[model samples]
Target: MTTTVRQILQKKNIQKIITVSPEQSILEALGLMAEKDISAVLVTEGERLVGIFTERDYARKVVLKGRTSKDTKVGELMTQNLLTVSPSHTVDDVMQIMTDNRFRHLPVVEKGVLMGIVTIGDAVKTVIDQQAETIKALSGYISGEMSI
Candidate 1:
């Protein structure tokens, strides 16, 4: 069975997503991320996703540029051109997208509505679990044949 983002979310029981406004300072977003123990925050404006603020963005746009996080707005540094995936997208699809883009986070959306986000860690875990299950089944089949 192909695993979808919805299945992943259900399996993980993850429902909440940390979000911040574009007008908010980078420091504020960082604080939220730290509080939530997340790497990224969806930059929203009245339910509209405008961008995504992440540690990578901070390192590249603020710290490396000598810009103070407290004074810099998230909109200035957040990634606006987001590559999102739909909830119906299979795990393999997302993995490929993330691999090609060299990023960790992917926003799960449906009908332009943000649902959840998945990380590289999540995808890797799913793939590993699937492989382990397959191996177990194959081993069971081989053992049954040997015993017969």
Candidate 2:
């Protein structure tokens, strides 16, 4: 059976989605990210996901441009042309997408509703866990402890 994004989200049990308004100051968004220990935050307008703000954006767009986070709006630096994924997508599918695009985070949406965010760390952990399970199952089968 393939592991789906829904399963990943269920396993993660994410309580709240951290988001910041487009009109908010970059400093405010950065503060929230710092407090949550996250490198990215979804930019929202009401219930609509407009863009994503990440550490990379801050480094390249703000810092390199000599822009101050306190004076800049998230909309000015956030990535607007986002690539989103649905819950039905497989773990492998998302892993490939993130890898090929060099993306560290992907937002999970279902019917245009933002569900949660998946970080590269989450994908790596899922793959590692899956491999461990497979190894254990193979070991059990070899030991005649379980039937295939």
Candidate 3:
């Protein structure tokens, strides 16, 4: 059986997604992210996901460029070109994409609607869980063989 995004979503307890408007200052977004203890926040315009603002974006675009976070708009520093996945996508599929793109988070979309977000930590944990289950099954099989 394949692990799907839906399965992961079912396991997650917190469904609150932090969002920021493109017109908002980077400092404001950062404040929300800090308060939530999240590394990234979706840049939305009335439910439309326009971009993503992350810590990396802050480091490279704002800090490196000497742009003040209090004055810069999130849209100016956000990553506009995004890579997203659907609810039906397998964990392996998303793992590959995250690895290939060096992405820490991937937004989950369904029929052009944003559903949730998955992090690299989540994907790696899922893979580890799958491996542990496989190992347990193999160990059970070996024990049964020994007894037979």
Question: Highest TM-score, which number?
Answer: 2
What's the alpha carbon RMSD for model 1? 2.2
As a whole number from 0 to 100, the lDDT of residue 123 in candidate 1 is 92
TM-score of 1: 0.94
Residue pairs with backbone atoms closer than 3 Å in model 3 (clashes): none
RMSD of each: 2.2, 0.8, 2.2
Clashes of each: 0, 0, 0
Predicted structure 2, TM vs. truth: 0.97
- Global CA lDDT of candidate 2, please? 0.93
> Which residue pairs overlap in candidate 2's backbone?
none
Q: What lDDT does each candidate get?
A: 0.87, 0.93, 0.88
TM-score of each: 0.94, 0.97, 0.93
lDDT of 3 by residue, 67-125 (tens): 99999999888998789999899999999999899889898888888888888888888
Candidate 2 shows a clash count of 0
| Residue range with the least summed lDDT across 10 consecutive positions in model 2 | 1-10
Candidate 1: tens digits of C-alpha lDDT, residues 64-116 = 99999999999889999799998888899989999999999998888988888
- Writing each residue's lDDT as its tens digit, candidate 2 over 35-106 gives 999999999999899999999999999999999999999998899978988999888998999999999999
